[model samples]
Target chain A: MKISAQEEYGLRCLVQLAALPDGASLTLPQIAEREGISTANAGKLMWLLNKAGFVHSTRGTKGGYSLQRPAEDIRLSEIIKVLDEDVLNKHCGSYTGVLDSCVHNGDCGIRPVIIGLHALVENALSQITLAQLVGNESSVDAMFHKVHSIHRTVEPHGV
Target chain B: MKISAQEEYGLRCLVQLAALPDGASLTLPQIAEREGISTANAGKLMWLLNKAGFVHSTRGTKGGYSLQRPAEDIRLSEIIKVLDEDVLNKHCGSYTGVLDSCVHNGDCGIRPVIIGLHALVENALSQITLAQLVGNESSVDAMFHKVHSIHRTVEPHGV
Candidate 1:
């Protein structure tokens, strides 16, 4: 399975906005340079984020994009939902590329596995705020490690 | 996120083989018809599965395809690995679609979240055997409910 390009890039862009000082904004050009994406792509992402109410734009010289709300209040789950409503639908589509429905649409063995994973992912993302992701890679990595250790102790999945 | 077509079709095809009686096998046509896929596509999927040592094929009119090992011995994790060695790589690719690497390659905040989700998914799939998937949709769905309820109690993620 894989995260969509829009979800990944849009999230990275938000992390950039999250890292900004309070009330500060970034231009599309700056975001493009920092994220290594085309300016047009960055603008597209920012536009979507803006329309989703996760970000607000300012006009004129020195004006740019900033988080609409505090980073601490923006959950990754919310960001993902804004970026792609078809997260699970995209997965289900793989079962029948040419058809609109799957052969096992009524009762699918794979459905439960996919749904369970989705719920777990949603739970994990719900616990993570963009504020948490504002840290550099190692810090964010450490945070996940801590959470995972706690989860392991609680469940002890012997995989 | 999305499961690859190869992974989905390959697993479904394997489930068909798993449901066969002892010493029984199914031809490409039979598999395709049962799964509502094209015969040529079925042949492609079976070829990959056979090459990965998950299934064996016999020649002649009465011969066809069968699992190389018992269904109970085959884990969903193994099936996924056979179908996709670049599963995580594909996700990483989404970060910088145009460039060879990401801007935050050295210290990426998103890396940990993706890695953590991958580990969780792997752990969950590892616990599920192909034999478990041989059941029809509802039985398999029920099985996941039991597992998920146990997981919920053990972890109690509020989300």
Candidate 2:
């Protein structure tokens, strides 16, 4: 199972917006630079986020994109869904069987098990908001920095 | 995220073995027939399960397979891992450069979020043992039966 770049970029874009001063709008280019994503891809992610009601955008030189609601109100699950990405494996079960030839016929023994997994993930993602992610950036940066330091120490000693 | 057929098949196979009379051995063909899976797939799945120490296979006439440990000792996570299928999404991060280059480094920001999701899923899957799923089959069957009956009743009523 894999989460595509779309979901990752989308969340980062949201977090970037959350990091901006309250009531301030940042253009796609600014977000792209800060988050280390491509301007075009950032724009695409923003368009989808806006369409999903997660953000509001304005056209023209003075206008740009901003959160439609408070950062805390936006759940990671919402972003994932809006990006049309699947964190769980989307096998035949989630599909509307073409020509009505689903192998399991909707009662596949494993369907409930996987669905339970999906629900658990959804619950966890829904609990994390843009506010939480942005607020914790410094901690994340510090952790990555520590990891990088450890890597340097271990690689030089080969221990 | 989606569960692979390997995991789904592996779990069902385990449940089937768990339901067997003590000390009884079941051949791959028998399992394939009962589970409505192809013999080749069943054999492949069983080989992986055996390699993971979940099952022991006998060779020669009347040879078959049996559980290596008690049903209660086998966790769903073990089965999934043995099957080499990830039960949750694991994104490395978003593409920092061109897609081809990103494929090499995989330093996407979303990777961390997905890793967190995987941990939660693994935790849940690890806590559920084969015994729980096997023992709950009766209740699950009853629930499905109820739903089936409801579907039958509603089918004729052109809603």
Candidate 3:
């Protein structure tokens, strides 16, 4: 299964906010320029994040958006849930349907297996907080280096 | 992160085969009827499963398909992988180049969290086998009963 662009962008935006000095806010335009996202899309993403209570936004000059809580308190699961993204494998007779039509139907023997899988995924996601992520600056830097290397390879020869 | 129709159908078909007596074969039509799937779709699903060495199909009159190995040996992960379906929250930066421009870039703190989630999902799926599913009838019965109840409630009044 794939995560949608909304979740991806939303998480990135949160990470950016987490990196800033405590209580500092960044305007949409500023964040957009720094992250290379279009200001329009950034505004939209920020709006959603604000609605989800992850960020608080202000409208006037010197107003922008800042995290509602410390980064360490926000779990990846909450971010994903707030984005309302579906993270399970969907199929006609799988867990998505009425309990009966599912291949396991009454007790069709595999319910535990699927449920266990769901729990494991949720648990893993819940364990990570924004604090842990921002704390590992070295790892994040290495990842950026990798991304840059890839970008250099993909750029047009003369550009 | 959704499971595709292929993986779901494939697992259902395997369970049907496992429920039968050892060495007893079932034709594509029988499987289609039992699982409420179209013959064409069954054929496609079977082709993949056959190629993966999960089942062996015979050629003419009285010919049919049967498990190539014991049901207990077949893991759900194997079926899903054969279909190129991954039940994990994949990052766009890891696969798509254009998305790397997202603000978090490589240093997005949440990457490790997502990676951990992916590993947990994979591990859970890997542990379930067809043998475990068919070993107990009660669980299967319960699943079907639950689905049936939901169907009854949702069905149109006249129908």
lDDT of 2 by residue, B86-111 (tens): 42422332323234424324434445
What range of 10 consecutive residues in model 3 chain A has the weakest lDDT sum?
A150-159
Give per-residue CA lDDT, model 1, range B23-53, as digits (tens).
Answer: 8999999999988899999999999899989
TM-score of every model? 0.82, 0.65, 0.70
> Judged by DockQ, which candidate is best?
1
DockQ of each: 0.33, 0.10, 0.13
Q: List runs of model 2 lying over 4 Å from the truth.
A: A1-5, A23-43, A58-64, A84-112, A137-159, B33-37, B59-61, B84-115, B137-159
Candidate 3 residue-wise lDDT, A9-99, digit = tens: 7887888898889779999998888667899999999998898899999999999999998777887768876675444433334456555
Kindly give the stretch of ten consecutive residues in candidate 1 chain B with the minimal lDDT sum. Answer: B150-159
Per-candidate clashes come to 0, 7, 24
Residue lDDT tens for model 3, B1-159:
444567667877888888889679999999998777898899899888999899999989999899998877777667777776443423555434444545556555666655544544444455456776776645434433332333233311111
Best by lDDT: 1
Model 1's chain A TM-score stands at 0.80
* Candidate 3 Cα outliers beyond 4 Å, as residue runs: A1-4, A29-40, A60-62, A85-104, A137-159, B85-105, B137-159
List lDDT for all candidates, in order.
Answer: 0.74, 0.65, 0.65
